[model samples]
Target: MEPVFEFPLSLDKHGPQTLARRLHQQLRAAIVEQRLAAGTPLPSTRRVAQAYGVARNTVIAAYDLLMAEGFIVTRPGAAAEVADLAQWRQMAPRTRTRTRTRTRPAPPPAIDWRKAQSSEKPIGSAATAASARGFHLGLPDHRWFAADVWRRLLLHSSSFALPDAFGYPSAAGRPLLRAAIARWVAYTRAVVCTEQDVVVTSGAQQAFDLLARVLVAPGHTKVAIEDPGYPPLRAALLAAGAQLLPAPVDEYGLIVDTLPADVRIVCVTPSHQFPTGVAMSLARRQALLDFARRTGAVIIEDDYDGEFRYGSDPLDALQTLDREARVIYVGTFSKIMFPSLRVGYVVAPPWLIGALAAAKQCADNGGNVALQEALARFILDGHLAKHTRAMRKRYASRRDALLGVVERELGEWLIAVPPSAGIHLYARYRDRRQAKRIATLAAHHAAGAQPAGDFLLDRQTTFDSGIAFGFGYIDEAEIEGSIGRFASALRGSYASAD
Candidate 1:
């Protein structure tokens, strides 16, 4: 047996305090200060009693007190062990330090991040919680996912047989994962590419950041983006020092004629526009590609939620139609699987892939190889495809539930722009007065949502005031009740538009 670890203790045999109480206090202070590390195995009660020249009963009582206070844990047939002291640390008060005075460090040098991004209030604050009744934009139905399958795949992919898994992963990504993604996107999004053209990213957001690094030249670069667009994309490009040119979006999608001729990059979400739920017309898709070809600008096509179309044929990706290699296709597993997975990819032209890969190396070295490996297996084994099909049906039902309530009960107050695909549906009110009323009601019920005006680059610019309902996270059964709450909140807040 291993010898019992010794801890210094000066117990007074003639003191007024009992031996057990003195022992308990010393042991607790040792544990709290980490003199005895967490998870360390404690000696047997009899052994501790003999080592300290005390009765076995004295040690037993002290151990019991420690266990009760969560300082240690004991098992029926095993040695008692120290419990993790993280919670205890939080509970303990800070030690007073009257002997020394602390001085604050000097402030950092001022930085001038010249007008590249917005100074408006953040869309959602850090403290905001994801409520069950809240309409989370672009979130998927997490309940429908197979956690057991993912757990097993993740465990199985953790073996270190491959050299990439053993050491730092390649900046370009694991070869197997890159190849799997190439095949997957080719099959699903009709994107044309090989493993050599694929660059694995943390997510589509990082892919955009990497592109901005390699493509944009700070103040000299002009980048065109869809107005009332994906806010994160616009913000990221602006932070990279690109002069942003916000173009307008119509019912058909981004108007190609309004694109600035001098811009070097154009970012769009054509499959399903964010905040509006509008898909670009086929003519518009072609016109976008032609515009990129003519202007010699790189097209960044972010297909974030293209996997879950409700009732239409999947359109050919902009990359598929680009014969001039002008489009950079960005895809992610966030919406389909889950956001925290942080797995997204970029299919760039042959000449640009190397530079982008190098830029990624300088950014984060590389992403988690084990997660990417498991995801690759998830794709090749057809689990991804199977899960996506199931989620599509469930989300479609949810979409119908929300629309049904709007059309049946709230027709006078709102008008839903029928969405053929994607998780969210956009609804415009007769005016901002009605929209604000509905918003106030939704907030009262803890069912939060975003106003369409939140995405506008220029609030003064003309646009419809509406709310976007992301039905993916909210259950179909709860949709009616949530709408009812909205109706109740709106009661007496405004008169019916009769």
Candidate 2:
């Protein structure tokens, strides 16, 4: 077993216990330098007591202090991880902005005619909690992934890949990874692509940002997104100064029949709609493509986690059926491999990849090459498929646990819409007003309360409102409890909304 440092007797005294304070200082420094990583196996309470001749509770108290300050995470059976330093850097305070606009402008009727996308907020809402760990959105548990193999590959590749990769990696990404991605997409999403078709990105968000940078002509072009959709997409578009429109989604996905005539790009999650787990129908897909072809618009297909299908044969992705080369396909291992992998690919129409790559080169100077090579080998070595299969089962089990918890707790109070695929599940309140009230009071209850209103276009009819739960990140033990709390919160909110 690895030797872990523990508190000494002198450190435990409430007064000037120099040794205890020194141990604390050294441990904090180790954490800062990553000597102690987030989730490292620390010594046991008895072991610490035995090692240092100090009381077991002294060690416990010290660890507890570090944890409360966001320095570490402790699981029941697992060792503590070095609190994510990268996440910590992101969580630093920025200039806070208060909403000066008393209310939203009265948008024109039928204004959604020009946008193509969903699940986005109007402006980047301060990216406030980036550093605090245990986030609830699009985060899959990485514990199940086979890291040893990738670690080996990264180690092996780092020695030889420096000359070609370190200085200026291809704007198109490494050719080997691109080819592997091409193969993965053909078999999985059924999209035909060469290595040239793939432009590796930081994640799907970057792909959206890149497209917004290249396609949207600032205020001159209007973009449409799904009403009550992903907030980040809307924020990215707005940040690019695009006039965004919120398109309504239903059982069929984005209602293309009502789409505006002038949109240059349509961003969509047809395989599994964001937040709401509805799959886009084939009829809707064809209609969207038809409209894009007629309008000369680009279709940005974010095939996010389309592989975890529970029932029904997976429908071909929109890009798979695009004959006009109008569809740009986006896929991310961020969901499948875990969020930190941060590698998502854009399979674009031939003309767009070059511009986007230049933008990428200028932006972040290419992603981690070692991780990229590791990912490439992972797919080539067939670990990607195996990991996906394992995770699908794990997630499926988690999904079952979530359903049981909601039914057991909320029962008739919450209507659970079972997901076909994705990390999250969505719900509409039987008493939405009450649900809102509970969510609003979540801070008081030590929970989060995100209203569905922020996702809508300020039109009451546009909001098919409910709660969003990212169940994949939470353990089974907490699923039922979370739902019960949510239901109870909703009960409280019911009184407030009235």
Candidate 3:
């Protein structure tokens, strides 16, 4: 029978070794190593030749050489088989002495990498569901996202083949995309900037990383981050060797009065304070800008979820008020669009744009060309604004539904933190210790519960315990059931505690 086995053999015509000789040597070595054992059938000459992209004569000659050397046996009208291993071993006498080789241990690392590593879990570590259900943070409802429209835009970008489109994209991003972003932000977020001031990033996370690389002086640069802030931004600052100063946040957002005097950089989610859904007060924004101007500190304003406001006019972005260009506005389409899109941008001042562009170039070479082009078309054609408006209405309805459930069902166990904007709302637990316990219970009920301590810089035990409930991801129709499940989970946790 013709044995079916992958011939893990190759031919290199460019080499000094001929294909037939190389094949012979390989087969001989396989037999010696007992890889091709006794009675193991080899593929026919035609099959081996076809598999290796060589002439049939090459395979025939190699097989003949192996047969002549007594490595293989072939009978009339029978396939070639490996000769008995015992016969080959007897013919080739063992003359060499055996020796044992000792392995040396690898040397210890020179640098203390432990200090450079982060002890805290990454952002959205708990949001591991295939689809966002109850209370999953940072996830928008993917089911509502316009997949068809996005597909069309992507195709539109691919349809026209410009010379530059075929090449590697610019590190700063495509000119069209940068322009579109500049116009879009200027109109929507009150972020006044030209295309020259924008540098497209993989996401808001990469924007922070690139900024850290350019602005931080490693081991000397002092950066101030909100106490219960976004983990990724804090981690980025820490990784850049900045001495992180965790500033406290109140109802109005980051308390500028509490900021340390020597901080050279400040990162804040001023639009809607992450996990807390509190917009930074106008007074606080002015104070922050004044403080930045006073100390020459660069403020990184992460306007992640500024577009989903239910009430009140859109607050002026920190970048809009920065007459001195101290505030570097970072925005992402992940929350506004979908997470996997991996498109975000930085509205940087002219002075910092060049350095940031260079840093981006060194990071991933450049952004995805087609993606950038598609996003550019998506923005310029008014699809982005249209989608965002539709999402805002839907998200607002979800917000109302969540608020209703919290007031009616969860009022006894938790108190709402008064959410004004953003996808999630924070609720302080009646019993602080219950915050950690409820998360596991919530999971059993097919839900999610993110503890406030997960976002804290120091993770102090004394920190007030609360849970962030994301309503943007789950449907309005499912809101009642999801909230019921959440209430059940809370009750279960309390029962266990009793």
On TM-score, the candidate that comes out on top is 3
1-498 in candidate 2: lDDT tens per residue?
A: 324553222345455654445555556666665556656666666786676666777667777767787787787878665577665444333312356678878877432423434443332112322332221556677677787887788898887755676476777688888999999988777889999888888888898888888887867877767776776677677767778677888867898976799887777889888767678889999999999989988888878888777766888899988899899898898788766667888998888888988888887767777777878889988999898888888878778887777666666556777877876766666776556454554334313324456566546664567655665566676665666676677566556657
Residue lDDT tens for model 1, 1-498: 333556567667788899889989888877887778889898889888777788999889999999999999988999999999697666445522244668888985332344445553344332332445357676776776989999998998787765656789889887888999999888888887899999999988899889988998877899988888887787677777788888888899899999978978999989888778889899999998888888899899998888878676877888898899899999999888887788899999988998999999999887888888889889888999999999988988888888898777667777887777788888887666556667666666535467777788867767766777777778876788877767765665665543
Candidate 2 global lDDT:
0.72
In the order shown, what is each candidate's alpha-carbon RMSD?
Answer: 7.3, 15.1, 7.7
Candidate 1 Cα misplacement greater than 4 A, ranges: 1-133, 496-498
lDDT of 1 at 36: 81
RMSD of 3: 7.7
The window of 10 residues in a row where model 3 has the poorest summed lDDT is 90-99
- Residue range 329-399, candidate 3, lDDT tens digits: 99999888888888899999989999999999999867888888889988998888988899989888888
Q: Which ten residues in a row have the lowest lDDT in candidate 1?
A: 120-129
